[model samples]
Target: MRIPRCYEPQPMNPGDSLMLGDNNVQHLARTLRMRAGDQVLLFNGDGQEFHATALEVDKRSMQVRIDSGEAPKRDSALQIHIGQSLSRGERMDYAVQKATELGMARMTPLFSERCEVKLNSERQDKRLRHWQQVAISACEQSLRCTVPQLDAPEPLDHWVRSVEADLKLVLHHHSATPLGDLPRPGSIALLIGPEGGLTEAEVQLAMASGFRPVALGPRVLRTETAPVVAQAILQSHWGDLAGN
Candidate 1:
């Protein structure tokens, strides 16, 4: 059987007997039905993975004996920060999850003019937590030791002016240039608009703030699909996806 990988929020040392709390109990106990002596992998988002064996398993609790730690940071050298406009429901969740898989260094949920999703402070907090969980799940599945940073939601105008990167790009289908014309950058700040797409004025504003307009192809993708496609293109061109 493929060993399961779980995220633990606590700091851990090799050889420690760790008792998992409410966070991981249900998943390991009921969901996976892991039994004592079953081996598993654990990570704490500390850029290391631990080889662990199930010490105890029950309905309420699961204990794991951590054996050793191995550092495996499956991160791209080209740091890419995705400024993604917030979409509704699964669309937003899909974007975050896929982008994490694509090796984005950070993600900033953007509130744009055309953004359809509306959230109060409480809803925003809840959504942020949900999004973090999505990223964590992605890391576990993708074998990425380090979880990507999830930034608090911010307005488009503020994020555009603040993000620093060697190349800054805003996706606009009507733009004159393809992505290949650009200089190779060690870091990129990529901006993707909402479902309705970025208004011409917003695109102009982003360009004024040092973002260059780029095109993906003739066919336009949905908001959720755009980030995953764009990140793949970028990674293929200059990031780790181009590996030997």
Candidate 2:
């Protein structure tokens, strides 16, 4: 059986004995029912993976010894930072999860004119933490060594003006430009609008801020689905998803 991979948010070195974090402990010990000597794979958001063996395990905790470490080339070569507008329900969660799997370098939740979701400071913190965990879980499932950075939710205009990248794109179905027509870029900043989509003024603001309006195809995609398709296309064109 493939060894379960766990995210241990601590320094990991070969021969180091480490106690798994509460989440991981619950997964390995309580959920998976792993016992002593069971093999596990671990990463700490570093660009490396460590092989480990369970030393002790119970319902509440699991301790493991690092057997070895390997630096795998799992991250995408092309960096894609997504400014995703917040959506209601599980849509935001789905976007964050898929973006992480697609090797997005960074993601910032955006608040646009048409955004339906509202959060105060406390709720914002709670959602940010939740989205971050979602990214980490995606990394584990996708076998990625690096967990993509999830930034706090910010206004659409602010992100469009402040984000840096070689190429910037705002998804607009009205645009005639295709992804294939764009020049290859080392890094890309992609903007996805909310359920109601970006208003004309908002699109103009992004365009004025250096984001080129690009269409995926004729059909308009959902707020959550746009990032998945956009990232896949960008990754396939210039990132690691091309050959693999």
Each prediction's TM-score versus the true structure? 0.95, 0.97
What would the per-residue lDDT of candidate 1 be over residues 1-244, giving only the tens digit for each residue?
8998888988888889989868688888889898999998999988899999899999999998989999975788889999999999999999999999999999999999999888889999999999999999999999988889998899999999999999999999988787667888999999999989999888999999999999888889999999999999999999888651
Candidate lDDT (C-alpha), each? 0.92, 0.92
Q: Model 2, range 109-214, lDDT digits (tens) per residue?
A: 9999999999999999999999999999999999999989989899999999999999999999999987767788989999999999999999999999999999
Q: What is residue 90's positional error in candidate 2, in angstroms?
A: 0.6
Q: Write down the worst ten-residue block by lDDT for model 1.
A: 235-244
Off by over 4 Å in 1: 242-244
lDDT of 2 at 55: 97
TM-score of candidate 1 versus the correct structure, residues matched by position: 0.95
